[model samples]
Every structure is written in structure tokens, then in C-alpha cells.
Target: MIEIDTKKLVIGMYVARLDRPWLETSFLFQGFRIENNHQIEQLQTFCKTVKIDEEQSSPLVSFEAFKPSTGRLNGTPPPPTAAPQDQKARFYEDMAQAKSVYDNVSGSLNKVLTEFRLNNYIAIPEVKSCVQSVIGNIMHNPNALVLLSNLRSKHQHSAKHSVNTCIYATLFGRYLAFNPEQLATLSTAALLHDVGEIMLPKTIVDKKPDELSAEEIAQSQLHTQYGADMLRKITELPAEVAEVAHSHHERIDGNGYPRGLKETEITLMAKIIGIINEYERLTNNPNPKLQLSSSDALKAIYALRDSCFDAGLVEGLIKCLGIYPIGSVVLLNNGSTGIVIGMRQDNHLLPTVMIIRDPTGELRHPPKAINLDKFRDKEGKPILLISKVLEVNSVDDDLRDYILAELVTKNKPM
Candidate 1:
């Protein structure tokens, strides 16, 4: 048994002992693998030290709590996510392709969202094509599309939310090993999930979710039925799309709106989109100023495991997006600032980062890139550990603009 400070424990460590008796803590098992940050938080809250079984499997990485950081950088580089086992193309190459596909799909989303808002109808052919293209992009290289989704927009809440949710759903679906046909249906459901919100009063729809009154909250919940009803009327779209639209709000423990669905009753796609929808919503909330950082949002959703979502699928989101997901701006333990550009499935803590600023708080003309898992000091210890995640809005306008405009054009990390 290896004893370490509670704060030093990373995700993959196996805990065989605790400073305090196990009975004192809420842990259900005598010994257990720390699977997510919630468990880590619990340990930190209750225990001063823990003994980890090094031999038991888990990712060997640790990240500090989320906080804001200052300073901006000028380097423009493409955001790239960690590719699946059979990576088809390099980061730059796939990034360009992903941009083209994303642009086309976003245009379609904006037009359809506008059309639905005006006339309550959208062309099925146009949306189906978008789904196919998005799925193809994900299959080719998952990095590019995800980076595109991370590019925040301050306008057209409905349109941007749909596209962002779609990107998140496809990424989650790919991780779940869904077939292409399954992806198409899942993507379609995701992209059009909120079309029914147009039926809502402009006053209710326009307000930040937290600002809504009790009556407005109840009225807003009707969008699921409104959306499902709209989708069901479209003969060309699959029945599952409507089902997902309606049931995505349903929780696993049967407390959700529209219809309270238990675990087995909800379709897998609805369940998948349900988790992604909440993550996307929190990440891209009605108020950008109130948007939760990626890791912060993950922690919020992770708290709802089993009761609000499937436990395994919740882990899938962490695996797919990582603790500090791609496009996250973070401060390193060494006092450098960087953006997360990639994630390794095995270890959610250790990700590939593009360094934006040096320790002196000066911008790196061309940002340096390194994989935390591979980069080490002279003693072979990892040199850079993420100290804190910077919120998107917390970044100054120039930094936000730099991320939106410059980050897309650069080809490779290093």
C-alpha cells in the first residue's frame, strides 16, 4: 500500500486504505478505484490521506480545481482532439475538412432554425444530409468537428445550441461504438432536439434558465412535447427522432419532465442525447457569462450519475471529452498558460496542450505544444500538470477573439 496526501491522488489509483476508517466515509466498498472527480472530492472533503494500490488499473493523472486566469496570447493554431485507435489523418489535414463540413452544417442549422421559427417547418432532406456529413467527419477525425463546436457564438442561441449539441452527441455516439446508421439517427435527433422551443413565449425562451420564474419553468418544460409532436408529424424523419426529442428530458430514476422514464424504458439514443444535452446546455447556457467551464460542467453532470443518467454513459462523457476538454484554456503548475487540444481515452487527466503563454506571463509567439503523458522532467516526472481551468468568458475579449479566429488556422500543435 502506497500512502499519499489526499490532494496528490490521481484518477487511476486504487485506494486500499484511508487515514480515517472506511466506515466514517460514505464509501460503499472496503476498497475502490477512484473513478471520477466526485469521488476524489469526497475523499478530499473527508480524509487527509489515502493509500492507493499501484497495481490496480486507473489513469495516472491529476488536475487541480477550476479557476480563472489572466493574460492573452497571439499564436493561431488548430484545435485537435485525441483521435481514436485507428486515426485516419493528421490533425491539420482533418481539421480543414472538418471546418468545411462544419460550416455547411452550421449554415443549414441557422436556416432551418430560422425557418422553423417563422413557418414551423424545415426540409427533411437538408437536415439528413447534414447528419451524414457530420457522421463522416467524426469517422474521419473526431478532433476537427469538436474544435468547431467549441468555437462559441454569442448570437442565435437556438441555432448554436442545436449544432453544439449535435457535435457533442456525435462524439458521444462514436465513443459508444454506434454504427453509421445509428449515428445518423442519433445526430438527426440531436440537431433538431430543440426545434419546438420556438413554440414557447419569446419572454420565457429569451430569459436565462436560472432567471425563470416557477411558472415559466413549468411552461418551458412543455417544449419537449412541442418538439416531439413536431418531429412525429414529419413522415420522412425516423420515428426514433421524435422519441429522442420527447424522452431526452426523462431521467433514469423517473423524475424527469414530459414523461418520467426509468432506465430500461428509455431508448439508448434518448439516454445518450439526454446526457449530452445537459452537458451541452450547461457548457453553453442561455447566458454566456454564466456558462460553466468544461470540467465544471462535467462535475455537475457526474453528480447525477445513475439517478439522472446511466452511470456508464456518464463515464463515457468523461472519457470522450476529458476533464479539461479540447479548447479549454488552463494554467499549468509551472505557471504557463495553455489550451487543451487533445485528450487520451485511457487517462482523462493527461491531455495534449498548446502552450499559449510562458511562465513570465508573456505570449509564446508560436505556442509550444506537448502531451502531458509523454513530457517529463529530468527525473522522469511529468513537468506540467494542469493547475486550474480558465473560464471562456473569464478570458478577455482579445483572448476570446484569438481563440475564435487564430486557433482555427494553425496546422499542428508544435
Candidate 2:
């Protein structure tokens, strides 16, 4: 660490220490990136000099100046080191493992949420264990859990939403190269993001904002505050975790509730959870009118870029999920219908698919899975390209049925 005058502070530097004890200030953490002009000003108010951790500082330009990789909205990033040639085979193998992981996590979350409803207490160790398990699985292979999350049961919306949000947030965090500690905190915060809802009456929580009285709307907004208060009472969690629960609802434009914080006032972890939480809700909202398909949700969030979320983080989210995220059903150039089963790091557009219907629109009794990236015609040209994305219910057969069928075939025989 090197001591530097606060006057010399710039964006991207990591402040390790201040001349004064950190507890005296409002800054949440003892160490943090000087991410904006406002933070520099805040530091100047608190300290004339600080110590910088040169190794931890981001070498990239300031968050405001950084640009998302090109051709993203236009195209996918160049393929990572060529993925395994038999990725489809590996995906199924991973799917079986991921299903087991999902079952475990779902059970744990149900217990936690149930406990919170009965008594306002949470078991910190149980949450930490679940977070570690999820992290290990995602780091092993990201596709399996991602695909399973999309198949969440509608009956268990609240519990499953938290689990899916935790997975998505962890995946996004991993894409950003967050350290283990940061990932743990992010995952834990996501797991409990909506915990405050447990405190509200079922009638109020179940109704949509339009159906609610003004008082009901106000009570609903208190979830953020309730969640933050709950976490603060749990001394085991890091302070930032509580901060995320409090500020995830806060928009960059200062229109958000609980606290109308704007831009820099929101912490980075909160921003990450905010983006993922919205995406999850849009895709899985109980109100069908409010629900959006994965592609459309991405577009909606992209439109809010700087005003509601960090632009670079949104781009990171798009990249992590891909143009046609797993579980999206699409029409193929071959006039067939299929569901995206896996993604290729090299090309997001050409994902692996499980063909459920033939060109004649007839259901294929046993769906056939193929890697679009590797499929070729007799002439050695690509055999199929995505013609259009379809709503999950576009086909006569339920999409969930197809996904469950595939999972059953991949997992141990019943």
C-alpha cells in the first residue's frame, strides 16, 4: 500500500486506508474502488490522505468511460478457446449434476423462507452452505444451472425466484471476475433479497400494484426496508449484504423507493443484484402481462441502460446470458421448432438445440438434440439457423414438458 494525498485520487484506484479510522465515516467498507468523481469528493471530505492498494485497482478506464465489447448487440464475442467438441454430451452430464444441485438448493431455500415466515430469524450457516454449493457448480459449468433455473415451477414462484436470482447474480458476478468473498456476499444477498415480503400480509403481497390501495402500495415498498432491517439484525452477514437488500430497488434516476438513492449512492453489489432481480422478475412474473420473454427482457433492461443500471454491467449480463439465452424456443431455418439447450462461448447465436417438432409442425415423439454450431448439410454448409424466437407457450405441447422430458432422459433411469 502506498500513501497518496486525497487530492491525487482518481477513478479506478482502490483506497485501502484513510488517515482517520474508517468507522467514523459513512463509507460502507474500509476498502473500495474510487469509482466516480463523487467518491473522490466524499473521500476528500473525510481524509486528506489515504493508502492505495495498487494491485487491486482496476487497470481499465473509469466505469463511465469503459465501452462494452463491439458486435454484442451486433454479434457475440470471439469464441473462447474452442469448447469441447462433444459439448452436447457434456451438457447432459452436467445437467444431471445441476438438477441434483438445484433440488438441494430449492429444499434449503424453502426451509429458510418458511422459517422467516414463522419467526423473523434466518440461519446464516445454512445460507452460506447453499451459496458455496452454487458457486462450486457454476464455476464447474455455468450452462446446467442456468437452463434449470428457466424451468422453475410456477407454483413455487417466490422461493424459486430467490434461487434463480441467486444463480443469475452469481453467474453475472463470475463473468465480472468477482473474488470469492464478493461472490459469497452477492449470492447471499440475492437469496434473501425479497425476505421482507414475508413480513407483509399474504393479501397485500399477492395483489398487483394496480389492484392495491395506496396504503397497500406503501406497505409493499417497505419490503426493501424490512429486508435491510432483518439483515442488520443478523450480525453474521457482511454489512454490504444488507446494503444490497436495501438499495436493489433504488434506481439510478432517484425514482426508486425505501431510499431514492441515485447513481453513485448505490453500491456495486446492489447494482448487480438490481439488474439480475429485474431480469428474473420480468421473465417469471406471476402476472403474464408483466412477464417478458428472455430476449425482450434483455432489450427492456438495455433501454434503461444508464438511467436504471450500470451500462457495462448490463452488457456483461447480455454477454453472460447470450442473445438467445438457454430455454428460449425458436423456429429454425429448416422450418422446425426447437428449444435452446446450451450456448457456445465462441458464438452466442448458434446455440445447441433440442428439436421438438419437424418442418411439417409435427411433434417429434422423442426430441432430438443437436449442436447448431457443429451441424452441417451434405454440402458441408450450416444446416439450420434461428428463424424467429417464440413464446414459451407458442407450441401446442408445453415447453416445460419438453424440458422435463430431456432432463428425465439425461438423469438416472426411474
Encode model 1's per-residue lDDT on 1-414: one tens digit a residue: 356788877776677678998778886445566777888999999898887654343445432231123333586444443353213234555566677887888899878877877787888888987887787666545656787677654444777778888988988887776755787889999998887798899999888889999999999999999999999999988899999889989999999978888989999889988998898888777676877888888998999998899999998888788878877789999899988877656666778777878899887876665778886878988777999998767666576556545455764443
Top candidate, metric lDDT: 2
- The TM-scores of all predictions, comma-separated, are 0.73, 0.75
lDDT of 2 at 158: 75
lDDT of 2 at 335: 95
Model 2 per-residue lDDT tens digits across residues 347-376: 787898878889998888667777787787
Pairs in steric clash, model 1: 12-58, 12-59
RMSD vs true structure, all candidates: 16.0, 13.0
lDDT of 1: 0.77
lDDT of 1 at 35: 70
Give candidate 2's whole-model lDDT.
0.79
